[model samples]
Target: MLQAIRDTHRYSPGELRTALRFLAPLGLLIGIFVLLPVLGTLAGSLYLDTTFLERRFAWFDNYCGLLTDHTFLQSAWFTLTFAAVSVPLELALGLALALLMNSQVRPLGLLRACVLIPWAIPGAISARTWELIYNYNYGLANALLGGLGIVGEPVNWLGTGAGAFAALVLTDVWRTTPFVAIILLTGLQAIPVELYQQAQVDQAGALGRLRRITLPLLRPIIIVALLFRTIDAVRVFDIIYILTRGGPGGSTTSLSLYAYRNFLGGDFGYGSAASALLFVVALGLSLVYIKMARKLKIKMR
Candidate 1:
């Protein structure tokens, strides 16, 4: 029996060689594609001015400088505030849309297609379109507001700090809410219709049904939607960049925007450190979301 087991455990040289040959390419590809870039970013963050190669090892100076910088701190605060406001709004709007679409409605297909249109457009293009819409001279927003006697002046939406921040949030919410709605719609569709019918038979009203049935079933999807929105909002750059360039007074300058500015200013070490910090923030958020997901799983079971 021992001899038979030993024979089974032993691999022939030819088989071992074939297995190594197959795995070697995969390992090499991973090293080149994945491992190298992460290592390079870390190395760059640690590097300082070097006459020999334009940069040299500077240890934690970049990170320390970033932590002490007022602009970086303000940018971080702005990013958190943006994400905090936008994420909940997206989830709420998305959930409402999903619920509305789930009901028997007129022209449902057409409505869904229209709802997804904003999400289909390129973010940059949408930002530019919104910029025009918010223009001080001929923008539709000021025209509508003026028509309603909401304001005497054609408000310069992109020409002020608060206006620019509001514009960024509105544009981002419009562009990304469809994504959350789609995710929630999938969750809603998976829910058994019988559950709703049962609730009706129990004489549960809309609020009760939503609280007792819909929300419980939709927890996972809600968590996932929040995760996606939070990460995206924290890293927001393109829309704000295109719309206001984090402008008017740096009101909308986020962490990612700061990183880009640093990189453009040729502060590679600082930029890399900011990027690494952003990565850490994103990773921490993902872990928290995953933990919440696990808790939901336990509750469900």
Candidate 2:
């Protein structure tokens, strides 16, 4: 038993030195930025204070208060609903775009570049652009609807709860679907053309080939793309900030926005608790994705 333990744990001095050298930079970064801040936030969340100047350890009081906080609850629900609605739409649109781009069309390179334009634009800029387009009067969206006689008057796209939510979702989908497409496009490109050739030789239809060959092989990439998009969607701030500012009756305030408001209001302890909750939610979703990927036997590189 002693020999086995020694064999398992032992490392030569040179190997130890090499390992430390490789790990040093990453360890330093994690310690300074990620580890210390998380520890501080967790510690801070347990206290009751205004700006940490007169803090008192409150144990789980802050968490308990959070559960009953209407604004926080609403923001949490909004964040979840936003992610739920937008991520799937983005994925579907992205997959469609990837399929279109993956086709053997003329000027495919140019088409791919054009498709990246929306994703290349900064989030704030895109949000502002969408805001203009969704404006009540003289906006392109309203003008188009009027031109097509779809509505008798301009619809207030961001003036009501449902409209604001829909507008936010639309803006997010427009800005993010391209990113999903680019990731999935790389995945689609990685698929061996020979598989399709074999399927064709077996007299498989296009839909059959896609269902049996393309999707199964692309499962890992799809999972990865969804994971990335879901994380981004959950923490979405800049776009919402620029477009709505959680306005039109606080209908679209997200968890991040709620935390920001609390922090700005000098409730550091509660703000930290909110931020910690956000971290936990993001971490939990990521773990779920990892488990699903593993269950699907998808090898990630």
Worst 10 residues of 1 by lDDT: 1-10
Cα miss at 270, model 2 (Å)?
Answer: 0.7
- Go through the candidates in order and give each one's C-alpha lDDT: 0.87, 0.90
**Which candidate has the highest lDDT of all?**
2
Give the per-residue lDDT digits (tens) of candidate 1, residues 91-121.
9999999998999887999989999999999
State every prediction's TM-score relative to the real structure. Answer: 0.87, 0.90
Residue 70 CA displacement from its true place in model 1, Å = 1.3
Compared with the true structure, model 1 gives a TM-score of 0.87
Number of clashing residue pairs, candidate 2: 0
* Candidate 1, residue 198: lDDT: 97
Clashes found in each candidate (C-alpha, N, C closer than 3 A) = 0, 0
Error of 2 at 256 (Å): 0.4
